[model samples]
Target: MVANLDASSKAGSVLIVGAGIGGMGSAQLLAQMGYKVYLLDSAPGIGGSMHLLDRTFPTDSCGICIMSPDQPSYCPTLECGMHPNIEILSYAEVESLEGEAGDFRALVKHRPRYVDIIGCNNCGLCVEVCPVERPDDHEGRLHEVKAIYRPPTRAVPDTYVIDMDYCTRCGKCVEVCPTEAIDLGMAARRSEIEVGAVILSPGYRAFDARIKGEFGYGYYDNVLTSIEFERMVSLTGSTQAHLVRPSDGAAPRRVAFIQCVGSRD
Candidate 1:
C-alpha cells in the first residue's frame, strides 16, 4: 500500500529499500510532507539507473543538473547528510527484519568506506595519483574509476570510497589527498532501526546484450547494447557524450538497432 506522500507524523517512520529513482522520489515527497523517512540501499551510492546516465532521453536534460548537490543522484543513502529529518544508510544492507506490518526492526550492516565520506572534498587529486583504474559500469567501458573515488562527478556527501576489491593498500590516495580523509583500516559497522512501514522499489535490470551472440557482442568492438549506445550518446556518460567505435575510436556511418534481443521470447 502506498503511504501518505506528505504525512508529517513522527509516530511511524517509513523505511525505503533501494534508492533508485522511485525510492528517492518517494523519500523526497514523503519528507517534504513532514514524514519521518529512512532511505536504505545496499549500494554505496544512490540514483541507481540515473547515476549511470550522462543525459536523460527525449529532452537530453543534463542529469547532473537535475539532481541536488545536497541530495546527490548518487549515494542516496547519505541523503540525510544534510537533512535533519532523513537518515541515509550507505554501504549498508539489511541483515535482519522482524515484527508486524506497522512495526519492524531491521538490522543493518554498513560496510567501510575506508575514506571518510564527510571529510573528503571530492577532489580529483587523489583520483589522479591512484595508479589503478577499473571499468566504470556507470560509463559502460568508456571511463575508468580510481581505486578511491566517488561514483560520479557530483556524488553526495562529497566523500571518497575505497574500492576494497581493487585497493592494494598502496596508500597513494591517502597520501595525496589534502583532506587526509582516507582511512585504510576502517571496518564494517552494524546498527538497528524501527519503522512503521516499508516500501520496496527494486528497479529493473538492463537486458543483457551477450545473449545475442550473432551481434558479435564482446568479440566485435563495433557492436554495443542499447544501453551502451545510450551512454555513448550521453553527455555525462563515460565518453563525456562522445560517440565513437570501440574498436577504432572512429565514428560509425551505418548503425543498426535490434529491439528484442533478450525480451519477448
Candidate 2:
C-alpha cells in the first residue's frame, strides 16, 4: 500500500493525519495560509470520535455545532469538505513516512468503501434495498442499520459505505441505486503524497470495559460502558435521548456512575 512520492509535487503542502476536530481545524487554518492541505482519516467519513458525543463537558453544548457570530450555523466538519485548498482522504491511513523535515513523503493506504462518495447522492435507496442488517457500531450497537449505511448525521462527504464483512454481495444495492454509485468489486488503493509538514492528531480510543470482567460489560445485560451510556443519552441515540436500562425498556429508578475503572493504575 506504499507508493513513491513525486519530487516535483513537494511544495507548501501539509498532511494532517486525523480528521477529528483538531485535524480538521488545522487543515482549515493551513489552507487559509495558502498551503495545500491533505486531511487523512481511517474512517468512512470525517468527524472522528466526536461523532459519538452527545454534548461537550463543562458547557454541555452540542459537540458537532461550531458556534460563530458570522455564521452561527457553521459546521466545521462539513466546511472541511468544501474547502478548496483542502483535500479530504477519508477511509485512509498513513502507512509509512520518508524523507526529511522540510520535505516528507507519506505512503497512504485507503480502504475500499465500495460506494462511490462523489457519485452517491445520499439518496438512501441502496440502504433501503440492501437485505443485510448489522448492529450499528456508531450507535454502540444499540440499533441496526443496512449493510450499506451513512457514517453519521453530520459526517463530511455525506454518503453510504458498505460494511463488506456483513455484506452478502447480493447486488441489491447496485440494482436499486438511481445514481449507480455502488460497486461491490471496488478495491483498496494506495498513494504517495509530498508534504512540507505532517501533523499527527490520532484521537483517543475508549477503554474497553470488557477487559475488567468484574463489571460484566458483555456478560451482564444491565452492565454498560461509558460510551454506551453516552450514546444512550444522546438525542440521536437508540432511545432518542431517553436514558433507559439496556436490559429492559423501562427507565431505571436508580443509576450509578463508577469513576476511573481502568485508569490510575
Candidate 3:
C-alpha cells in the first residue's frame, strides 16, 4: 500500500512516524508547501495520547470544542480531529529502513481494514446489529464497544473499522451495512516507500496509576487517572461523562486529583 503511494508522490518525499499533534502539524505544513509526505504510525490511527484525555486543565473546557474541527477527528473528543493533506495509516508499523537522506527506502506493515472504507456509509448499523462487544480501549475499559465502530463521532475519513479478534464471523456487520462495506477476508499487507527525510514523533505513554497501590487504581472503581477522570467528565463518553463510581454507580462527592504520581521522580 505504501509502495503504491510512494511511486505516485513527486519529489521531496517525507516519512513521518507517530501521527500525533506534532506530526499532523508538520505534515500539513509540508504538504501545503508542495511536498509529498508519508505519515505512518503503529496505532490503529492518529491522535496519539490526545484522544485518551478528556479535556485540558485550569479552565476545565472541553478539549474538542477548543481545537479546530476542520481536520479529521480521531475520536469524539473535539480537540483531536482532521487534516486534509495527511495520509493516515492506522494499525500500521514500519518494518525496516534503507538508503539515506534525500532518498530513503522504508518498509511499511499494514493491517487489514476489515471493513470497506469506500462503500460504508458510517451509519453505525453494523455496530447495532453485531452481537459481539468488547472493551472500549478508547474509554480505558470503562465501557464496552461493538465489534465494528467509528473511533468517535469527530473521526476523520468518517469510517468504521471491524474488530477481527472479537468479531464472531457472524457477518452481521456485512448484512446490516447498506453499502456492503464489510469484508471480513482482508489480510495484512506490506509495502515500501522512498523518502527524503523521516520525522519521528512517537509520543509519551500514560503512567499506570495501578503502580501506586495506595490508590487502589485497578482494585477500586472510584479511583482513576487524569485521563480516565477526563472521560468520566465528558458527556460524550461511555458513561455519558458522569462522575460516578463504577462499583456502585453513585456520583462521587469528594474527588482527589493526585499529581506527580510517577513524575515526582
> RMSDs, each prediction?
3.8, 4.2, 4.8
Write model 3 residue lDDT over 16-119, tens digit each, in one string: 88876666666666666566777786766566666555566776654643343334434332222343445666678889988866678889999887877778
The list of candidate 2 runs beyond 4 A from truth reads 1-10, 66-73
Q: Estimate each model's TM-score.
A: 0.86, 0.89, 0.84
lDDT, candidates in the order shown: 0.72, 0.82, 0.70
> Whole-model lDDT, candidate 1?
0.72
* Candidate No. with top lDDT: 2
lDDT of 1 by residue, 1-265 (tens): 3344335443368888887767777787667666777878776766677666666556665554355443435444345445566677767788888876666788888899888877877777888888888877666665678777776544444467878888888888878889888889899999988777788887888776777788788778788888788778876676767788888888888889878788864
Off by over 4 Å in 1: 1-11, 62-83
User: Please, what's the RMSD in Å of model 3?
Assistant: 4.8
Q: lDDT score of model 3?
A: 0.70
lDDT ranking from best candidate downward: 2, 1, 3
- Lowest summed lDDT window (length 10), candidate 3: 74-83
